[model samples]
Target: MREMVFEILTPREIEAKSMETITKELGGRTWPEPEFSIVKRCIHTSADFDYADNLCFSEDAAKIGVEALKNGADIVTDTKMAAAGINKNKLTSLGGEVHCYISDPDVVEEAKSRGCTRSTVCMERGAKLGKPTIFVIGNAPTALIELHRLINEEGLRPALIVGVPVGFVNVVESKELIMTDDMPYIVAKGRKGGSNIGAAIINAMLYTMGR
Candidate 1:
């Protein structure tokens, strides 16, 4: 066997190369401008070109999200990892804050008492916080379900819903339900999302605006 050779690259250099690769591979395929740029960024983050086919967006999703951010909207995520993954500096520059309550003692206790996942209560809690908010649900289908309920039954209208929870159980159903609702949303159709993917979507918007 031949000896293996490896080369290390800086993070910025790696990211530049990835973007070049994605652009080249697109091969003149015309994607909806602005929105498609963010989608491409997500694909870069996950190294999952499948996002080009799986990601769906409501007509006004990108516009609403960017406007909300410009006007200072609060962002909520189902998991702490998603919250941590967001670009805080960019978010703050736009006067937004990222929130995650899944691990809160109150949320945990409520979940146990109600026989539901912490994500459900955390989303409910987030909905009550106020309007012009963005909910990024990446790891829990139940959280997406809870948001739908709050929007329809409780009339809690958020600024934007990023529903991309990755799982075999209830994930597809949850995303489909969100698609049916009269709200701005970015969804990963099927079961191919995670905390990182969720953060990537939000960061894409942030990066777009920051530029």
Candidate 2:
């Protein structure tokens, strides 16, 4: 009979070991300063090394995102689960807030009236916040599409767009649109992202900011 063995380690130790392993497994590939941090966190969260290759960042996007967070840029997500997963204490301490409006009564009503998705209306509402904001869309492709429309037509420029929605529908296309736009963005270029990836990206920036 084979003996069962358990490696005992604290949560912190386990995380440290995991990161070390990720770094070691990457071989000679190297990532830039802040981008490295973001990539590592994404890999840590998903246990998937593909994040290291799939994550796309616009010119100076990591810098822009960190600066926005420092200057109290509010964050809006498509789903409450992503909102809940964020490091709210750190964000609040930085004088920023996290919001998810998909379930709002007004959003629901307006989407129903317009025959569109609540995610579309949620982006519209987020655009109206009139503050430095970051849009993290990890569930609905419509949210990304609406954001693109708002940027092109209504001239709504967010601090950063984290476009990493997962699915086979419009997910890949929406992310492509965001990447083409001349905005500071961090996107996962494929149908391989989720709410957890969105939250992981935010937390990575927050942690990099010394929060």
Candidate 3:
């Protein structure tokens, strides 16, 4: 079954789209960090709002940060949350805390240059297991219904989830893995979204939490 899915990208298309979006976002400026480009695109693609409003970038920390923000997460996961084009100041000014989760000492140094104080890493924070721990599984072949089963059986109902699984990855299956109580949820047209789409919930949660 795994072999049957995700054939759409054709390798070249993925590279083309990824590169195109990366270049557009960069606008001739060299990427601060190459890996972040993937993070930037994922956030931009998944999020449902214009960064001009309330927004925050969780970086690879999307799985945990996404849920946290959904539950009033004022703490952003990355120090470059501002560069991601999310309205970082708006949320901060409103008293939302930004949790910049960085693992690399070099990245931490870079984050300090970017004016970051609160940050951590997966090892520091630990593997966010159970049902509610996000995982940002995109474009998985499984549908929302079955995913919900895992959530129900495993008892992983996170505070908020922006399940916008796209592509051929098991993202869809992962997306459906939460919300047994009709919890706050946001989803995009399958294959029409990405990880950052979860930012809307993050912002909303921050707004509510700060209020």
Candidate 4:
């Protein structure tokens, strides 16, 4: 007969153990610690280890995100789901809040009038906050496109952008557009990201600031 063993661990302990397991499973493959930890956390959230390769950073992506958090930058998301997923407690501690205007009446009316997606109108409205803002777009490529337009054409500057919208249409192109800009960004390349990944990336940065 084999003996049965039961071990209990706290949530933090379990999270640490999970990261250790993810690191060990990667074998010889390595990324810088900050980026690796972000990817590892994404895998931990979605159980999709392929993120280890799919996630891409723009050299100072982590630094920019962490600095934004520390500076109390407001965060905007294209979807309410992503907004809900963000750790508001951590962000509040940093004097920031998660915002999503997708369901606003003004956004809906404007999108209808313009024949564009609500995400596009939402970004247009949210970008006018005029504060240092971090945009974490997950489900809508159109939002990303509008953000790029605002930045390039309308001259709206964001603190940082975490663009990882998942879909077949314009998703790849929108992300590509962001990469061309000289803004700080953290992107999950390919067509394999969603609102959860976007929120996970934000939470990972918040954790970095001990938030």
* Per-candidate count of clashing residue pairs (backbone under 3 Å): 0, 0, 23, 0
The model with the greatest TM-score is: 2
For candidate 4, the per-residue lDDT at 42 reads 90
Q: Which segments of candidate 4 are over 4 A away from where they belong?
A: 1-6
lDDT of 1 by residue, 53-116 (tens): 8889899788788889888899999988899999999889888998899999998999999999
A best-first ranking of the candidates according to their lDDT comes to 2, 1, 4, 3
- Candidate 3 segments whose C-alpha is farther than 4 A from its true place: 1-72, 75-83, 100-158, 179-182, 200-211
* Model 1, position 108: C-alpha lDDT score: 95
Rank candidates by TM-score, best first.
2, 4, 1, 3
**Candidate 3 lDDT, tens digit per residue, 47-66?**
33222122223233334443
Q: For residue 184, what is the lDDT in candidate 2?
A: 91
lDDT of 1 at 67: 85
- Candidate with more favorable, higher TM-score: 2 or 3: 2
Model 3 residue 173 lDDT score: 40
User: Tens digit of lDDT per residue, candidate 4, span 1-211?
Assistant: 9989867898888998998888888886787756766888798889898788888888788887888888999998998888988999989988998889999898889889989999998888778888899999999999889998999999888898999999899998899999888888888888989999998988888887674
Name the TM-score of candidate 2.
0.95
Q: Look at candidate 3 and tell me the lDDT of residue 57.
A: 30
Relative to the true structure, how large is the alpha-carbon lDDT of every model? 0.88, 0.92, 0.40, 0.87
Candidate 1 deviant stretches above 4 angstroms:
1-10
